[model samples]
Target: MKLLVVLVSFLAACKAQNPEPCTSPALLSGQLTLATQNEQLWAFARYLYDALGQRIRLQEMGFYQNKSFTYDALLLYREGVMYEINNQESTCKKRALRADFHPMAVPRNASLMGQAVLGSSSGPGQGVLVNTWTGHLPDNARYLVTVTEFGCIPISTSYRTQPFGWMVTSFFNNVIGISDPNQLNPPGFCQDALHEEPIDFFSLFHMMK
Candidate 1:
């Protein structure tokens, strides 16, 4: 009954979107550029990566505040690829909004930098979110990067490959104990991250040194 109540409350508290007709496809096409100079994207990049400083431990639940709402994110990796589930919340911000819908599969010591356009099928010829994300990892870095939820705010949609925007301007508070087979299963554990308050990526960067 408690679980049912949470689900019911989530459905009621959350505002669902009635999407208008999609006039076009949400097409994003671009090459991976590690050092591309797209000013807007770089700004987002700086914000997301904490200027290449925030540190995250595998399986650790991290929260970032933006627009008075908190985003729940988990940054974990195994073998060589980095796994990220940017928006993971329940009973709040459960609009199923996703950022980085495709888990950024960054290789160890390599960067996952690319330019892409998020299009609106309903908004023909109009790119909903336009930006590039450039991230570099230390040779020994365990986590991929950090985000402020809507940190790299993009022109958005309520539904997309990665979902967001125009749907309640969501706020999420719960950042742990959700069901993901991959949760905390990796080369390392997130006990350290859970024990300490999330530090600015800058401080995390220093820890790497």
Candidate 2:
């Protein structure tokens, strides 16, 4: 009985030490990093309306000069890949979420090398996303994408389950490492992902329109 207790305690301790093996997905690779690294966040934002067609249409946008935001990239650690984007426009426009927020761009096939830039000096931000397929990538062109990072401020799932909004929020909270402090309650129809608190989704949409 004593041995059994010791074994259980040991297992519990091990579990506590390693909460979860966190692995970031590779967003690009090689020379692509050069094109993307050290670039402004909003420079490459675009929106992809129809992804099913042969040639995907891309609508790009820039950031509001007044507001400063974190730049992001798509990284696949397991595959050793990364993409760099550096461009900015001056405009504040609204389009269909399908056409404005989510744009589809093509992925590069070539590879290049670079001295790994330290975290602070340059390179990807904390907006890292993991374990999620970036839907379908284009074959001929490099698709402009916006990787938005979101945090669950305080909301419970039980109370809130908006259509596509909550589904996204939940993905950020449960799978992407973003944690929520409050239970999502007052369950009702919600249209925004951030129905309750500030949940940033700028990290996921690489292509912002």
Candidate 3:
């Protein structure tokens, strides 16, 4: 009986050490910064993401080629479309977006790297616990992503891909829910925006440069 009790306790401890996968909140808003070496672009954006509604909105400002630019993008995964609005020129363009909504979660195939506390772990409420995972992507790209262990809030993501070098995006200042649902709507100017052939969303930044 004594040996059985000890074995049960050991199994419980092992289970506690390896957590199950977690998904982020369905609705969230946050600030994100992105950098890409090959593109030589640095961008900051305020984003409203609605995973349940399958849409997202981004108000982005970036510098490339020593020039500053700003734009707003509304991505509708369900509609398979994206609206890119140039706030400065009051011009908008609509294009196909052949991507599905990707929730901020650790992929099932991801290999766990490790876990650590971001600050003092000696005391409760003194630090955040996080987990890191790495996986390969299509096109020979690889990714390493970190997220808060509790809510699965994304902390950072790094992608190594051919032709693009490395691109890193860090997320911060996240709030659990969308404050304004109307923010998901496209701007009025986009109503009659000219339809263009589908293009990769990231390439839009380079075109502006």
**Best candidate (score: lDDT):** 3
Candidate 1 residue-wise lDDT at 99? 20
Across 93-209, the per-residue lDDT of candidate 1 in tens digits comes to 111112222222222333333334445546666643332223333333222231122223322211111112112112122232223433333223322222233333223212221
Candidate 2: tens digits of C-alpha lDDT, residues 1-209: 99999999999998774322121231211111111222332333221112122111222334423243333332222222222222242212212221122212212332211112223534566234211112222323222222222221111111112221211111122232213211111112222213122122333333332
Tell me the lDDT of model 3 at 27: 94
Tens-digit per-residue lDDT, 1-209, candidate 3: 99999999999999997955678899999999988877677889999989998999989889876788776888998898898877678788899987767887878888899998988899999999999998887665789999998889989999984545788999999999998998798777788988899966556666655
Using all chains and alpha carbons, the TM-scores for the candidates as numbered come to 0.17, 0.20, 0.90
Return the top candidate by TM-score. 3
The lDDT, on a scale of 0 to 1, for candidate 1 is 0.26
The per-residue C-alpha lDDT of model 1 at residue 1 equals 94
- Rank candidates by TM-score, best first: 3, 2, 1
Model 1: weakest 10-residue lDDT segment is 40-49
| Model 2 misplaced regions, further than 4 Å | 1-110, 119-139, 143-176, 181-209
lDDT of each: 0.26, 0.25, 0.85
Report model 3's TM-score to 2 decimal places: 0.90
Better of 1 and 2 by TM-score: 2
